[model samples]
Target chain A: MFITSAYAAADTAAKLGEEAVKKKNVFPPFDPSTFTSQLLWLAITFGIFYFLMARVVLPRIGNILEVRRDRISQDLEEAQRLKEETDASIAAYEQELAEARKNAHTIAREASETAKLAADKERQKTEAKLANTLAQAEQTVRKVKDAALAQIDTIASDTTQAIISRLIGTKVTKAELAKAISKIAK
Target chain B: MATHPDPIKQFAINKLLPLDINGVDLSFTNSSLFMVATVVLTSAYFLWSTGGRGMVPTRSQSVSEIVYEFVAGMLRDSAGSSGMKFFPFVFSLFMFILIINMFGMFPYFLTVTAHIIITIALAMAVFLTVLVVGFGRHGVGFLKLFVPSGVPMLIMPLVIAIEIISFIARPISHSVRLFANMLAGHITLKVFAGFIVSLSAMGTVGIVGSILPFAMTVGMTALEFLVAFLQAYVFTMLTCMYINDALHPGGH
Candidate 1:
């Protein structure tokens, strides 16, 4: 049964081959009859494809790419500008800080110098007042000493007169006693 | 009786809509259907992927963009920035061929590129575009492409003749390369598959032996997929180089 089926298949294959040969002696590709149809369809389809590509599709894709590139570059430029602005502000802040510190240093020095001058003037005034008080005290001491010396002279004269009278039981004359006292004092 | 599996039967064209213009048999065959499908699929993918036009591409959008950039970069490298004017044309050819070739990779799909007429038509389009652009840009000076600079005066004529012949033969080679690759790859795959079928019909031992051809068929299918992509790349790359030649006929 298998052999018979195989033989029948071979016979049918041969018949198909004969039929193909009868229809066209040439190979299907080499057959000139079908060229026109193939060419016609290729031209039509390729023409449509070219039209769609050129008119609609490619340009849109290209535009998308272009826009994306432009956006990226613009973003980069904006970032760069912001960075520069930040740097400038920081520099200005630092400079102001430095200037403020210098001003504070100058003001402190001026205040110390004024305080020192005031202190020196105050000390000199006190020293002059003290000297005046010391001179007056010395003059008063001298006057007191002179008054006591005068009193001492008077007292001595009286005492010497009294002693003479008491001892000798005689009344001595002032001139005589003075003459003796003067000689003794001398 | 099991029907005989004809490998060549896969390549046969079938009329879907019988079209006639004048005396021409321009019927909408299976080939036409595939071509239309390729166009529609390619168009839909690009349109849908790029619909959002997002600054950051979505996954589908990224795929679309990658293909766009890949072809653009290839063209820019071979043809210089000035040749970017032909970007749409080159892009269409690349995408169309690529999608159609991929379509052909299915089990029972018609390979539009497998047809000689289709490939020749594409190559001829490129050829004619080169002629037009070369002449339009350079005028008579385009003939200088045939004459190399610094050739010895004794051998100058011979060189120009050879250059002209090669130039004339460009379309033939370009078209045949794609057609033959698709045709041969598909045929090889079908033949191996046929072996498996016939072997399995034999019996228990035949089924075991069929494993070898089955593995081979799998391998061939994988290779065919690669060829589909590679041939598309090669075809477009050559297109770029040719356009470059036209744009700069001096070959500098």
Candidate 2:
């Protein structure tokens, strides 16, 4: 590339190449062949970047995906297990409920049977008491009929004796009275 | 005839050094400044453009997307599905080189791309990566990349050696392709620009005659702009192709 220079004195123009570059105290414009820093930096930057990407960032992303997959799988499996547990519990409760219903029915039937037996025993006892009461009442009626007959005969005998005394004026003997009374009672 | 670059020499600035601890000569020079500048400009522009993140992209974001899609499309077309894995690498290289080439076109800015060392270093990095990737992926089978099928058994050794030489030469050719194109384009532009100054210095006929070179310069400038973009793309595309060969050796 052509460049214009206004700074060159006659003495400075005489010298060429390295001496001139040094006189100016300027590093000779870098030769492409000898440039080292840029290349080294390139390799270092790329190497670091590669390692970071390969070892750190990518692996982390991959691990996250793997962990997410594992979590989802575990969650699904747990859900299935919980579903089974719930189903089993439901089944167990249903069975227990049925058993309780059966037990309650049996108890109710037995209680009704015991109640029936007690009621029959009470009926029999009451029937026996009524029979005893009827017998006592029949005995009382016979007693009362016999007493009334005796009273009626005694009153007739007395009245007959009184009439006889007025007519004949004689005292009656005990044996004769007894025989008359007995005949009158019959 | 000036012996050394006057404007370039004037432009050189090495104000500060970063490597004081080891005293390892990690001085910040004019090139370092431009390198940092390029990185900053690229990062800032992309970050600012996409930072808002509207679905309907803004202008910078739109440009970013087009470049992205363009590179991605090239990768897919050249390298197939496996190229998706290395998208970030290829994309960064593309953007970096594209920016550097464009920066070279600017009047005062120094181009890192123009430097053979820079281009060759970048190329060698890509080459080494391709080597590592291919070997790492296929192990012994990767050697088959250098050995074609159906070659005569007697000449297979010669073929394999030739293949290795060519494979080794990939980085060189790749770097040279970009380096030569940029160097030629810029030199021609400088010459034509000189002519424009000289003609403008002349009174009247020089003015009219200046249009010929000026028109050619403008036209060539447009063409050079295309070439700057194309060279970066070609370098990146060839890198992908190399990587693809690594991923799927045995010529598919």
Candidate 3:
């Protein structure tokens, strides 16, 4: 308003008022009359714009981006948790397998030791039975040999008596034959 | 039709609905219409894009998101994360300017940015915010901004005076740059187009001769499109830098 009044006064005094006002630069931007309205509208427009941006639009966009980031990070954490679980299961399986192998080894060693002890017991029992049989066989052989020697003595005595009787033509006495056989046996 | 189409006439403000209260004219204008249109268009675009609220953005959502990130990144680069508090302000300014600038390139649309008053209004807002924030946070210490470190004390007064003058001139330069560029580009386009119109009004020779100006107009239109985007970018970038200065007055 100040600028416009000053310019208007200057224009009239310069004597080029009519022509200057007609042209007026046609640049309505400099027209002080519109400045207030333009300024008023600008304030209103910018105020509303700021409210929309700060309160609604920017916050919405920022939220969307933030949610996406959190989702990605959550997925990564889940993958890590699954990996740890799998590793634990694998470790447990390996531990079980080792335990099974060690059990089998101990069981095999005990079975082998029991079989050896049984075999040794069986062998000792068989050897004692054989020794008893061998002693009985030796005693029977000695009795048979004594019986044969006694029979041979009897035969010789009988043959001697018969030969004496034929050569001398006399009957041999029983008591005499007995005494002679006795002397010869002695 | 008049013999000459006044290029300046295109910039003329007309009262669509006139209202005066207390000796002040408060009227709806063509400028006001376009500005309101820009606001509606921008608001609708953002709301529509975000309405779906998809995790993976749709086309419009992606576009809106890109614009958001672009301004966000600019703020981050200039003022760090602390300066993101002003994101809404800067973004609104950029979108408002960009849409209006592009609209002006169309056949019948008015460029709001072509006016010095509009730009000055916007620039003044940024300048005032910088001052308020700078002083509010730093107290009297904010004056350190005008006085650079390592300056010799003897010439300090002169340097300080110059710095203060430049600081005051920032909003003027900032606003004028955009206003002048838009105003100049549109004026040039209109002038060249006027040449074609006047030339064609003549005989076959005039029609053939209008080819040069026609080609120039086409080339200038293309250049103006680049300038439209460039001026908006420059304004937003400068605003961010100023905000950064306010937030960190120590020049760090």
Best by lDDT: 1
TM-scores for candidates 1 onward, in order: 0.78, 0.57, 0.72
* Candidate 2, B149-176: lDDT as tens digits: 8999999999989999998889999998
TM-score of chain B of each: 0.98, 0.85, 0.97
Put down candidate 1 lDDT per residue, A67-91, tens digits, no spaces. Answer: 9899999999999999999999999
Query: Rank by lDDT, descending?
Result: 1, 3, 2
TM-score (chain B) of candidate 2: 0.85
TM-score of 2: 0.57
lDDT of 2 by residue, A55-112 (tens): 5433433344456568789999999999999999999999999999999999999999
lDDT winner between candidates 1 and 2: 1
> Which of the predicted structures, 2 or 3, would earn the higher DockQ when compared with the native?
3
| For model 3 chain A, the run of ten residues with the poorest summed lDDT | A18-27
Find the candidate with the highest DockQ and give its number.
1
DockQ of each: 0.56, 0.05, 0.37
Question: Candidate 1: what's its TM-score on chain B?
Answer: 0.98
Where does candidate 1 stray beyond 4 Å? A1-25, A101-186, B1-4
Q: Which of 1 and 3 is the better model by lDDT?
A: 1
